[model samples]
Every structure is written in structure tokens, then in C-alpha cells.
Target: MAVEVAATRRRFTRAEYYRMAEAGILGEDDRVELIRGEIVEMSPIGRRHRAFVGNLNQLLVVRLAGRAIVWVQNPVALTDDTEPQPDLAVLRRRPVPYKEREAWAEDVLLLIEVADSSLAYDRSTKLRLYAEAGIPEYWVVDCVAETVEVHRDPGPEGYRDVSRVAGTATLALQAFPDVELTTAEIFA
Candidate 1:
């Protein structure tokens, strides 16, 4: 005779995740993000990905200095159980400095992910997550294809508007229409 047993997994809240970090279970060097109440290890950044992030940061900062804040590799709390650090996030200029409080999903104007190794995850998981969180705009910069996948009009199902920008096409943020970057400059 044999007996049946059930197994269950534990889920963590954002507070618990921070507690883990405070207790030394998670370290500053650990590249992990909270996803749907689970701690997920992030993909290692490649040279191409790193270059694109730096390039985008430089371009956005120069263009939207006073208009918006360009956040680099910083975590934006999407929910009580999810906080993923994006490659870059354009945030609305607020009176309260971000140093006083971390950014929330509503603070984001545009979120960007540089995809090389994590292309699939960025497209599927991150895209859906950002959409569900009501992120106004999300961009996936494909290093391999040298293109940008733009998503807008977020909803519970996902982004209602999706488009690919390539060649000499200009990429502009919905929040700041005047700010633009051509694909040529992006790929370079």
C-alpha cells in the first residue's frame, strides 16, 4: 500500500523579497528580479546589449533632460509581487526625487528592454507583465535583428498596439512626441 502526498510552493510579497535582501539571502551583486511572487534570475548582459543600453541612455538624456527622467537598470515596482529592473525607463519629472522613493509603474512614461539572450522572455513574459501593469509604452530593442519592437495601449490582455521599427525609421516616445531617435542611430 502507498500513500499520496501533495507539494506546494511558497510565494513571496515585495516586502518579504526586501527582507530576504536585508537578511543577506540576496546580495547587491545578484541579478535577480521579483516576478509574480517568485525571485527570477536575470540573464547576463552581453557586450552588444550593454552598448545599446548606454547608447539609449545617452540619447534619451540629451534629448529629454528637463522633460523627463531617464532611469537606467533600475527597478520599477509593477505590483506587490513584481518589480523588474528595466534597461531604461523614461519617467515623468516629479517634485519628489526618486532617491526618496523608488519608481512605480505609474511613474514610467516608457520602458525599454535590450534583448540579446533574453529576447524570448522579454517579448513574452516581460511584455505581458508590463501590459498588465498598465505600462503606457514598452520597447524591446533586438540586438540580433537590429530592430525595435514597440508596444503601446496597454490592457489586461496585453498591448493593443504593436509595431516594429527598422531601417531609418524614427522612434519616439508617446509621452514626449518631440523626442525621437532613428533606427540608424540606435543600431550604431
Candidate 2:
């Protein structure tokens, strides 16, 4: 069988994404986000993905507890994209604190996505969106490849520095000093 597909792309903004969310176009359980104005559905999490994010969350809690916010699976509002949730986020400390509350883009110091099946989208789409918004740092926990790609140096365009860390290799944080993680631990 043969089929045809359009080459054009969808355009949207953070406001529009919020509207959709408010109108119930996206449900609470829907694992989707507006990336570069296009709605992208995230793959259903399996054991591996959940475990990785969970482990990272624990590590962040221990190291960045009072210093930094160990935020997990929360939406970060960005331009051209509304609240795209990342797996784990090490957020900058707030004045009053919102630990039990949800996190927004302004609260984020580092945004991380644990990618097993959606690696390309995380790399191409979310990375660009994060950089364009001047996100300080971004990390991709590559489960399939067993590596962590650290992204930093956010400018108007995108990140300027990117490095991949393998097993037993520690990846450091820019804003959160003394906090480091190894690939093995993240995947463990």
C-alpha cells in the first residue's frame, strides 16, 4: 500500500497550548507536549524509563535538597511551546519554595528528559526549544545507548556545549555545585 503525507508543519505558541490544556483537549493523563508548536505524544513509560527517572530524582533529593529543587515530571512553560514536562528537573531555589507545587519554566535550572524510544525528538525538537528559551542546562538520559548527553550554554539560538557521558562517568551541574551523577547510577 502507498500513502501520501504532507510536508508542512503545525505552528503554535505557549498560550495556545495552555488554551488546549484548559479546554480539555489534552487530558491529565495524556503524555503529550507542544514542542516547537507541534504536539508530540510521549511514549508510554515502561519499567526502565520510570526507574531511571526515579533514581535520578532520589540523587537530586539527596544532593540538592535545600540548595536546589529536585523537581520531577513537571511541565516547563516555554515560548512557542506551553508546558512541556521533563522527566527530572533540578530547579533554582525559590523565595518561599514550591516543593509540593508544580514547576514552571522560570523555576527550572536544569531540564532533563529520559529517552529510550523518543531520542530523536528529545534531541532535535526539545533541545532546540529549550535553547531558544535560554534554558540554562538540559540533559538527556539515553537509556538505549547507556549514556547521558549534557547540554549547556544556552543562547538565543540553542545550546553551545554538549558532551556525552558514559558509564561510571560523572556529569556535573552548572548551577548546582557538588552535585554529580554517573551513567551507571542513573541507569541502575
Candidate 3:
């Protein structure tokens, strides 16, 4: 006899996810984030990834100090079903600290992902997620390629503008023209 059964997977809302965390079902050591109603395990940060994020954080903080808040490896509430902790998030300056309330998509000026082992996931899943959230700008620092991929002009369909800058080139955000970052410095 042959038997067939269809298996169903459970999808959780943001509130439910938070409840799980509060109830101690999820531990502090867990490297996970909610993505499109599913709990996705995040890759461990390698040396290159950590160094890249650290450098970017230093650069952005120095360049945008008092102008924007530089958040490193922190969660950004994208939607009720999605809260992703990007590698770095440049947020709008708020009267109250983010510790009082986490930054939502609307507060995000720029989101960056330093992609090495997670390059494919960052370029595809994370890209779509950020675009759907209407995040103004997104950057994927492709360590393997030694280039940065910039996405802008977000819409329901996705980012209308996508460009790649080589390691030797410089990148300037349209929103902040005064802040320019060289790819070499970022990838270094």
C-alpha cells in the first residue's frame, strides 16, 4: 500500500514571533530573523564580514554624524511579518533613541548588507524584501566580486534603478550628496 500525505508548514506573524522570543522559546544566542512570515536562520559572521561592517560603520558615523544614525547589525522592522537585522542601517535622526523604539522601514535612510557567504540570499531574498518594504536605498557589498551593488527607486515591483560600482570607484547616495564613499575603502 502506498500512502501520501501533504505536509503543511507554519508561518508566524511579527507579534507571534516576538511572543516566542519573550517566552524564551528563542534564545539570545539564536542567530535568526523573521523573513516574509518565516523564521530564517542567519549565517554566522565571518572575519571578512565583520571587518567590512566595522569599516562601513566607522565611515558612515564619521561622514553622517549628527545627520543620521548608524546602526550596526540591528533589526529594522520592515513589516508586521518581517524584521530583518541588516549588516548596517543608516537611519534618520530621531528625538528619542532607537533603544526606546526600534527603527522601522520609514526611518531607514539606507540599508546595507555585506555579502560573502550569503551573497545569493542577500541579492535575491533580502533585495526583494527591502524593495517591497519601500526602503529608499539598499546596498549589497559583494565581497567576492569586490564591488558594491546599489539599488534605489523602490516600488512594489522592485527597485527601478540598480547599479554596480567597482572597488576602485566611489558611491554617493542620491539622498545625501555630500556623503561619498569609495568602494576600495569599503572593501578594504
Model 1 off-target regions past 4 Å? 1-8
Q: How many residue pairs clash in each candidate?
A: 0, 0, 0
Q: Write the per-residue lDDT of candidate 2 for residues 49-162, one digit (tens) a residue.
A: 989999999988997867887768877777545568789877777675575655666677899899988899889878887887778899988878878888999877778999
Cα displacement (Å) at residue 122, model 2: 0.9
Off by over 4 Å in 2: 1-12, 96-104
In angstroms, give how far residue 19 of model 2 lies from its true place.
Answer: 3.8
Candidate 2's error at 9, in angstroms?
6.7
* Alpha-carbon runs more than 4 Å astray in model 3: 1-6
What is candidate 1's lDDT per residue for 115-148, written digit by digit as tens? 9999999999999999999999999999999999
* Span of ten consecutive residues with least summed lDDT in model 3: 2-11
- TM-scores of all models? 0.94, 0.84, 0.93
lDDT of 3 at 70: 88
| RMSD to native, candidate 2 | 4.1
State how far residue 128 of model 3 sits from its true place (Å). Answer: 0.9
Tell me the tens digit of each residue's lDDT in model 3 across 1-188.
Answer: 87787885788988999999999998898889999889999988888888889889999999998888888988899999999999999999878888898799999999999998999999999999999999999999977778889999998888999999974888997779889999778877
